[model samples]
Target: MKKVSRGQRKQTKRFSLHSNSFKQVVKELSKTLVSGLVVAVASNFLLQFFQNQFNFEVAWLFMTEWHIELFILGIGVLMMLYIWFTSLIGNRYIGAFLIILISIILGISTQQKMLLREEPMYPSDFSMITNLPFLVKMMSNTIFLIVLILLIAISVSIFWLIKRARKGKKEKKSQHQKEVRGLRIGLFVLSSLSLIYIYAFNSPGNLVKAAYNDHAYWIPYSQEMNYYNNGFVGGFLYNLNVTPMEKPEKYSTEKMNQLLLKYEEKAKKINETRSKSLKDTNVIYVMSESFSDPTKLIDVKVSKDPMPILRQRMEKNKSGEILSEGYGGGTANIEFEALTGLSMEPFASNLSTPYTQIPSLMNHFPSAVSYFKDAGYSATAIHPYNTSMYKRKQVYQELGFDTFLDEKTMTYADTLEESPYISDHSAYQEVLLKLEETDETDFVHLVTMQNHMPYTDFYPETTFTAEGTADDLEAANYFQGLSYSDKALNQFLEELTTQEEKSIVVFWGDHLPSFYGEEVVTVNGKVAMHQTPLLIFSSEKEKQESLGTISPIYFMNHVLELANSPVSPYYAFLMTLEANLPAFEKGMYIETGEQESKLEREELSSETQQLLEEYDLLQYDITIGNRHAETANFFSSK
Candidate 1:
């Protein structure tokens, strides 16, 4: 052994110190990276599980090529965040627990919503935090228990981690801690920048979107499919849609005025042929909740017809179907379309529920209530359910409803057997009461709650049986509810006939009921899945004509036409739209009676396409763009 000099001894110690510091950094980074990898991977899986059937194989089929990259981005973000949070707390275990707990909570919520609504959660949904208590009441006890158990488990885990971390905690005398501090600071900054960049813009050229251009599917008609194609993180980020869409290319005041002028002339031409008017009749619209035709929408082979009266009327009366804006849920959106004569499809993909999402953005509120009120009718809106849902009270008040009645204020707030909602019989009876109260012509819009989700055995006894693995318990229960609704409607019609005033009851199913698997819906066909029964019956006998297929956007137009009612220019445009495009849902599916109902606008006549584009322009102006039509006499009195 050679005797070492003082300088060499110092150098040896310095080298060892640097090497140990490097090892410490590597060790900490490796642990973070591994934990992040597990979290990100598990989160993506949870997202897929939420959107798809819980079956792994089914989820696997929906994964896109961009999934891997999405996970990479998610992992990077999580790891960087873990590193920074751990450094700040000086405890890796606690930080890890916090991250895991938050991610798991989000997953639980997304999964619950997906299972119930068949729609992915959006950031806009968080704004509904104020209604958390009421929403909890709406959830099934099983889901609530699952959430409770998860929270308890996480609490126990966090407690254990805290105790363990505390036991190992020590006062540290630093050995050149500057480099480690520098490393953490860099990570924190990098993480912050990365997050800001990813979330800042929803433009096509955003870094994340550009990188996954191969699978950048923004115009997803089905938001569930959007999540299926995009990984959880990517899909969630997609819902951070600050901009609804780029402004229309020709969205100028002059252009809008010109379009309105053309429609105004069309309205005059339509008015020339009309003899009677909606002004003279009491227009009652019943937007039956989840009141879909299962026999058609799902092709459910039942022991008996669920809605025989509706079917009979469908064959004889001016009845067919309207493309529902929602499936399983989105009753409000369907109502919004029918009430306002605006299509949901024209709005951005993220404006899934316009009643909640887009209403706040509107400076002018126009609906059937406005048109009816203009015609000197007492416009009353009724929903025998939560007043806070979709913020209906505020929306209705703004829409100029003379009276808005919810469950809290309803005269008959009775519920059927085992059902949480008000029964269709009681709901119709409430409408009958409204009709009797007022001698003046009325415009009554009733959104019944008799057929909402969690469709178990609502009816005590039913003869209906459906074809399914579990004998289609949900479908059977739904069919039974429909039977009850059918009886209620028949009774209501009889009651309407007894009334002295001439009246027209426009009844339609908001959307299909929940419980059907996505696979079943897909096999049945998207257009078929979305089409719900639309019946326009009157108090007195009238000519029955098949109106073919149509959408809720054109619903009021049909109502006006069937009633021989005068039309506003806006109604005239919608009438033209229905003529060109008989049925439309989210702009993805269109049914022209001549052609087999197609899923796209690929093979349309040029004139039809132009009309549809004009419809988009009008809808965009109403919801997102300027109120050009408000000034151009588009909604002028007939």
Candidate 2:
């Protein structure tokens, strides 16, 4: 409205230009900050989803609290990457898109790994990504839908960012601005290195200690607990470089030779006193899933002894408690010990499932199957579940199983109404079929799935209900399933009694059911949870014997003793160890004159220590180290 002067008009135009530039700068900074924050939040959500799958309340809360710290770290890293990438590429949108894309992919992959394995992502698991299609098939439709939505959202976000970035005008930067950018990046890198060092090597406080510890003992024995106590990211990174088995002290080829010589001499002495051969016997092992005497639980009473026949047979026959390496889960570990004559106790605690980790790597593992195969026995593995679950199909082949019959190949015709798993009766039928089909002696390992967990309506009408517990449906359901298992076992043994061919049946519960609370394990008593009934029946011999308490690793040795089967040097060593440390699993063991207690190699008797060290070294050589097994024919039957 005032009289227009050239100088005043010029000043007003400059002010307007400066105001618009300030707004533009604010908008660009907002885009960068918002994009970084979005990526960070998405990563946190993905990790939370993984935690939720575990269904650990404490872990969920811990992750919820720890995610804030992770978010902050993620934001800082993304911000630095954004600046550096933009500087390098001169395209802010491309840099942002890459950061988002990589973060999304990694987060999704981590989630998938955790969901499938029930453990955080490890470097070893990267090799299993080829099974992604199978994994996707196993996942629920909900997961696929959510994953699709996530991909779409990310694509849309990338498109918006690209549009905004392309619309931005490029300008020559001043030297001062360039110098400032370089200084910021340098400071950022230094800060990042410092944080990484602290995270990896230092225990600053309780929170940091939980997240990471330099101590070797903090390795993931209980993966769920590790992830719960440590944040997901912390646990995952810590396990990335974990050695599967630490070399035993004083381990060398010379030391190994000396140990083998000592054991071989001992074995020779033992073999001199024996005259036994498994030449004509068909050996059958049924590692029943979640099979245990539930009546052992405190304050629990069922309508009938779920395993009356098994209980009666155990009382009269060669039977005892098997101290399992795992509780509720880890069936493969139990099977591994039984078949390989290697106690898992000596390996890294985090090496939970050997089938997934160790056996898959080798072309031929020293196992009961291999030993039997060498003895002219055809070995067959039968499991009524997906062949790909735990990668058992491949593992069986590596373990020298001539044939693997999984769910797809099984002739099992019936399944329980309440459960998707094949009935135990049907599984036994398949075992009998295999026995009849084989003209030569056979070694059949049948891993049943009828009694597997999530005992949710595993039985349509609960015939055997728990009376003492207040509305414990899970216990009732578990008891009913066990009753069915007992009936199936009785039927199978009865049928076996009719067969004329001499055979040895080794029946054992892999681990206890996870129906009751986890606290029930330690609270009721150690024996109730850790001990499962193990019975070895001989069709030709009627004599009854008792093995007080033993580990699953000694199962085949006991079978050989009962059947007078020829023994390998490794198994001979196992037999001797079993006589001394009769019950030894992961944590607890029973000494010759003492009750079951937590034991360390250092606390063991000198003789026991020497034996365990030799055992550890032998197992490490065969499983993790350069196997020198063929030099001594360690697995060959004498």
Q: Which candidate is the best by TM-score?
A: 1
Report the lDDT of model 2 for residue 618: 86
Clashes of 2: 0
Q: Which ranges of candidate 1 are over 4 A from the true structure? A: 1-38, 49-52, 55-66, 77-95, 112-118, 127-150, 168-197, 203-205, 212-219, 275-277, 297-299, 362-365, 438-440, 469-471, 518-523
* Residue 309 accuracy (lDDT) in model 2: 85
lDDT, candidate 1, at 514: 62
Candidate 2 has its poorest 10 consecutive residues by lDDT at 211-220
- Give per-residue CA lDDT, model 1, range 295-321, as digits (tens): 664445778878888788767677887
* Model 1 TM-score relative to the real fold: 0.85
Clashing pairs in 1: none
